[model samples]
Target: MGKNTQDGTPGSWFKITIPCGGKYDKTWLVNSIQNHCSVPFTPVDFHYVKNQARFFVQDAGIASALKDVSYKICDEENQKISIFVNPSNVPYSVRYKLEPEEMEQLKLTMNKRYDVFQQALDLQRLRFDPDLVDHDIDIILNRRNCMAATLQIIEENFRELLSLNLSNNKLYGLDGLSDIIQMVPTVKILNLSNNELNLVWELNKIKGLNLEELWLEGNPLCDTFPDQSTYISAIKDCFPKLLRLDGQELSPPVTVDIDTPYLIKPCKESYKGSETLKSLVLQFLQEYYLTYDSGDRQGLLGAYHHEACFSLTIPFNPEDLAPSSLCEYSKESRNMKKLKDPYLWVQLLKHTKRDIVCALGVLPKTQHDLSSFVVDMWFQTEMMLCFSVNGVFKEVEGRSQGSVRAFTRTFIVTPASNSSICIVNDELFVRDATPSETQNAFSIQVPTPISSSMSILSQEQQEMVQSFSTQSGMKLEWSQKCLQDNEWNYTRAGQVFTMLKNEGKIPEEAFKQIP
Candidate 1:
């Protein structure tokens, strides 16, 4: 069959014949042509008939060159089989295929349009290039495939392209421009004005560019917005670093220097009250938590005032780090901001020491980390003292057992009978522990118990006492006595040592190591 070229001239057709019974395909023939011929050309309308393949070429020079080359196709036998490329009787037409000559013309045209000093390639109105017009090759950027080919050429040759002007290209969509970032990621300025782009979303296809300047004033998408500011705002959302849009200067983007080091004040307890009040609060916390973490919740009955009120709050939206099961506390969480129902609020709150202790018993058994405590004295007066303790705790035995939690507990205490203070009001807030909090919780080494004739103590119990003594700088006898007084609990033992040490109540001999 005969086909005509773009200029109404008959294209040159050639038939390639290989050795009969030889194992060969069209790809083998194409590779052979590329290997043998010095000039580059694509086989248009390629098809096979038996053991022969016929193809058309628009460029007469490439067709003549192909005929002169001694093409050889190697078969399974490793024999050099001669392949013949002879002019065919049938004529063929070249539709969209660009021959070697036309490709060269396109490259020459691009070279003329490129500014080497500025590293900019101006491809606007590419279809009107006089050089490409003679070869009947119209470079249309609107065609995705055509645009891709053009970009491939630019990426191979002008790799350092920093600015590209693709204006007046009649581009309606940016699908062809999606890979522009990968091709030239450093490109800072882009001109896409005078195009047919009508939707703001089309720009999303090229969102990753670190473009500092963009030109889209003449596009239909610009007209869709109500005003210039709206257009600028919509475009700026796609490119945060854009400093100029359509020749207008935009405000420089506000960016944080993430690389700069920031000074984080060390975490420590804050006490705004007098030293006497501070010591009192510390002692009270040490005693209260020791009993609270014990097996018996009823032991805390005297710690609370007769009419003490207790309530618990948790975050409304828990994070992924939260324990998988929060059923233990979620049902009782009385966050006043989230739980607006006044009746439920009154029902969840515990009034009086007995009610508070019962409510605490229903919750999980816990082991509080004394070292993680960060106490803050909020207010103090002759009548009452208010303070808050933030710390981490582990659920020792429950449905959420082994999971760590961070909590903040606030207390309002007043002097009770016998010169003792009791909690008049208590509020507890719980949340998932942060990564650092979980790591730092209970990290301190407990003192190790000294070898003695405490035959009843288990090996684990001895180790706990020894660790506590080592950590508290107390002799083994005093450390064991302290741990025994606190039910052999390391956390409670350490807390008692700290309170006694701060109050000057510990004897000087207690700090001495065992012989």
Candidate 2:
């Protein structure tokens, strides 16, 4: 029924169990590989033992240290799908040509897997034979057409897979889909727009996607995509801000609407926030969010200074506002058009409290329009959405997709603590896609609605603040300080800020001045 792989190692020797109990053994694994292997699948005679599940595979430099491999089943976009070989080590090669017969076998295998995955996805409506997928599968050929009858089997079985693909297939109905999509972290691309999908949650797991694109034009989500802007928001959690939506490069002036309602009239006039000291607030927001000990720290400083007057420095609470100045969208600006911006301020408040620890009302997110950056923002204390081109912008250069060098940023409020707030800023300059390198970008958070003075402090702590402030010519508002310019030139002045904050020499109030 089957033989060993080219290396004479075990392949089909592995066990596969789908949700509906379609158990496949090593024979099946060998049959699929042997049948489909195209030009890339080099032939190397090897030895194997089916009973012991042991095999010695010869190497044509195809793969190495591969302990085992198999297909894994998973539910994606309301259909059961099959992912190819589960490997233990890094695959030796990615591009592999497929023989004509092998391609046919690949289709059959995927269709069978799709059927089982569907059964598990729609357990309530369709219940068919279970699956038989085992071991870790690496590749997932999701683009080919699967027979309609095979889809029925997936409704009964759920085989957790690494990569799931159903690019162009015959499938209908997209219910019971949230959990399956969430579980897949290695998914590359998914094309399910032609299928029927009504709920937004099915594709809400955008944060965890390792995906390059999602081809979703024909789904129900498109009609409601505009309304569910918050849920479908494209957050720059782990990818570039310049996204390719359906193969088209997303342009500037992007916006998203977070579902929270922030128009509640403040107990006091919004200007009450203006009472907060200016130098103190600016210093806190600027330094706290600026990247520390990084290349862009200086550039970040330049961003705040070169743009501060031109920039609308909206704080999280009333203190960030001017006590005397009336809060109004008085005039359009050189940098941004402000309509009482809320996102930037919230980030400032949250970081200040982290330094304070027990201070409540330190941060609160709000709903507002900041036309300057071309953004519509709504947020909770810890979350935000930039509802149009305003919040995102990009410039790129590349010869190809893999060689393309592009950059983008997504702004949000990380007001959970002082670190959260400041970290958001530092993260902006720091390379998100890589460990090294700096970026030119920034984001803001809203302030807390309710707050109180620090209760976690001892009298000694107050004394420390008093002593430090007295020592410095200026008030010791935040724990961080400029790295004497020299340090920033050599390293980063902001890096000194992080150190000082950890030492507790600076006061929590200083977070409002991070720049």
Candidate 3:
């Protein structure tokens, strides 16, 4: 009864119903119904007086095909026969009959090699029957020659499944797995161990899943790592919020900084600066931008240290043409390749002041809006201060009509002998503004100016707040709040921070600073 047809297509049983009360030709109805079905089937025995007809559908997922056709039994009532197939209530000969398109989709998904799905279908049927007690439908180690299509079938039908054990199934890769991950987000525990996966990068397709535990032991990918510690890095990178991997319980990082002062609604341009470092960076940027815009080669001669390196990368938009001077720039331009060039390396290694001057002079004149600036500064080492400046610079005196380009410049400032700081390493990236960004270029809504004295703090007190914020890993606004809350006493603020940190009440967002 389970044998395939001449074309190697599988068969399922379905019951066809029609009205017998009216003058209907039973022979014609059966012949027409069989021809109307999308997949060919053989009708089982049935009398003309008896309206019930059964068929062995030779093709999968054709139960819904019978519903698409219409046969008028009589004009008085306009009777329409609708075919309904229930998988659980099939005749004694047919063990499993797919219900409709939805259930057929699940039944058709099982790999045909092992026929383990025949067992899975029975298990699924029992789960849906109200008379049966609830049980787990864990599809483990069936070795059904599984593939991405198999997972897709399971995702459509078994979304409520919590644990799935597909280990020892000879699964080579997880292509098209994102569909399952998206469909079955409720899957918390998954075991895919002892498979042939060669890289963990395949797991990156799965995003926004609440996966608590994942198993990939005995895979070729695991063998590539020297130890569990090395492999865990890949796992953590792909699954940022995962709690467990390969049966090992992982501890999440303490992202909340307890010692950091808290600020509220801080200004974008505000810097959590140290007294000497912040002033030096701000002053350097102020003078640098002015000289950059002046288009004078001599003005930029003193900004770089003797051993400094400078490189600019332009991420051009496909729709926007590169300037005439920067003709080689493209949408895919990156400094990584340019830095490796021996010719460019020689110029940067020599740190020729004239070369730096000429490089800056050849570019179109730019007017950097300091008010739109967003600054982030941190000390990489005791002797080195690193900072990144992000803002929009308008290209003026060009063929284009003052197109705005968003720019980011990262600088490693080391203290010069004369108490001033010069950039030791300067990396710059410039890109055309997106449509939304171009529209919102000047539409930034700043915080309403506060009348509180916190806005009117002395330069020294303001620097103190910045210092506190930097040292404590807190936001500038939250640091202001702490200073205002503790009457500008660093000692009292320290105590308050300790209390909050001990109680695990510090907000995680305070530690995040946009670059």
By lDDT, the best candidate is 1
User: Compared with the true structure, what per-residue lDDT tens digits does model 1 show for residues 381-403?
Assistant: 66677889999988988667878
What does candidate 3 score on TM?
0.31
For model 1, the superposed segments whose C-alpha errors exceed 4 Å read: 1-97, 256-515
The clash number for model 1 is 16
TM-score of each candidate? 0.36, 0.25, 0.31
Residues 467-498, model 2: lDDT tens digits? 54454433333311221221112122333334
Q: Any idea how many clashes model 2 has?
A: 112
lDDT per model vs. reference: 0.70, 0.29, 0.54
Better model by TM-score: candidate 1 vs candidate 2: 1
Candidate 3 or 1, higher TM-score? 1
The candidate maximizing TM-score is: 1
Per-residue lDDT, model 3, residue 2, is 22
